[model samples]
Target: DVVGLDGAWVNDFAKQGAIADLSALMTEHDYDDSQLASQVEVDGSTYMVPAVNFVYPLYTNDALLADAGVDAPPSNRTEFADAARAITEAGDAAGTAMPLSLETPSGVQNQVMSWLWASGGSMLKDGKPDLTNDGVTETIEYFDDLYQDGVFAPGAFTMKEQDMVEEFTNGRVGMMVDSLAHLTMIRESNPDLKFSISALPAEDGYDGKRGIPYASWGLGVSESSDHKEEAWKLFEFLMSEDANAELASMAKAFPGNVASVPDFVEDDELMSQAFDIYQAGYPANEFTGLPVAEDLMRQMNEQFQAMLEGDITVDDMLETTQESWSAEF
Candidate 1:
């Protein structure tokens, strides 16, 4: 049986032998996945075919930045922090929106992890948990400083992703790191709201290619499927350049096939800008193929909230999170 799944859960299914490896089928059909945005592999065996990617880019309120006297989008962490603080101080809107709700803890993956990834930081070393590394340490410290400065939108600990989007759409926040898939919804929500999309700011002095976080819709076959050949036919069609392009266009997402460009890029300036950013950076989502990925994010989110509330030191938060993640590994 063929199945659609979140790219992140591919590994879990593969580990349990619940999903069939698509490598042999792909080879038999002469299907090339080299051009795809990401491949879900477990123990060097491909188990999932990515269909579309929803990339997370920085979204800034044009009027808010202008009112705060910020002439341009921040390129580095220092500038981003200063600009955020300035926006908060200049008006009622907070500098940035952060949704830290434990119920939907992927915020740690989409936002918190994106901050680290943007600057070439990694929470994994040798494909395992390494949350206490210098990069992660610095990232946590940076957010802690922002929390202390009160630059994050209110109710962060209780806010969900949709709430964060609503905050930005309503002019309650000056900036946010969100998915490009939301562009249409955002514009339709408030036709007069002026905004721009750009890459997430890197750390100061970091000059390497940035890491752009992404979520993907992936397809796979059931391990016990009787109609394996039929499923392969479906995969072949969907991954074809033309079909992939159409799907991405309908979803307003980046095509899974790198060679297939989306149609929206031509008519939408923001989409065009997002494409440029994607081309300049690498797709990054460390949790995509990990075991118990969502749980791991929730674990980190809890520690992060504790740290933000001053209930734990950064070191304590990191140490606690590291231990928790290692247990799963």
Candidate 2:
């Protein structure tokens, strides 16, 4: 049978032998996977094929920025913090939105960890937990400072991604780091909203390429499926250059096939901007393909919330999260 799943869960499925390896099938069918952005491989065996990748970019409310006297979108962390503070002080809206709810802790991956990624920082080093690294430490301090200074929108600890998106659409927040897939929904919900999408702000003086976080719609074949060849046919068709491009365009995401370029950029200005941002960075999602990825994020979310509430220090949070993640590895 055909199996639909998130790219992040591919490794776990493969490890459990729940998914069939597609390497032989792909080779027999002459399928070229070289262009795909991500391949789900376990023990050198291909397990899943990512179809579309939704990249996260910074979304800014132009009117709020202008009201706060900010001249342009921030390119680095220092400027970003200044603009956020100005927006909050101007009483226009909260500087930015953060969804930190533990119930759906993927925000730890999409929102919080994105900051670390953008700055060329990583939670893992040499494929192991390294949460206490200088970069991770600094990143945590920066966000904790923002939360303390009231720069984040209300209910951050209780908010989900949908809630954050709703706040942005309703003009209650001035900025957010979010996926391009939500572009159409935001437009349809608030046709008059004026906003722009840009690359996530990098750490100061970090001139290297930023790491843009992404999620994917991925597919695989069940190990026990009787119709393996039939499933292979469907996968081949969907991943074809033309079909891949069409799928990405409809979903407002970057094509999983690197050679397949979506057409939405030509018709939508924001999407065009998003495309530029996507090209300037590399896809980064360290948690993807890791075992117990969601559980790790949940553990981080718990400690992060505690740190924000003054119940724990940054060091304490880092130590706790590091130990927890190390156990998984």
- By lDDT, the best candidate is 1
Cα lDDT tens digits for candidate 1, 165-242: 999999999999998878889999999999988899999999999999988888899999999999898887788789
Q: Give the Cα lDDT of each candidate.
A: 0.90, 0.88
Off by over 4 Å in 2: 23-32, 43-45
- Cα miss at 112, model 1 (Å)? 0.3
Span of 10 residues, lowest total lDDT, candidate 1: 29-38
Q: What TM-score do all the candidates reach, one by one? A: 0.96, 0.93
- Candidate 1 at residue 60, lDDT? 93
Candidate 2 residue pairs in clash (backbone atoms < 3 Å): none
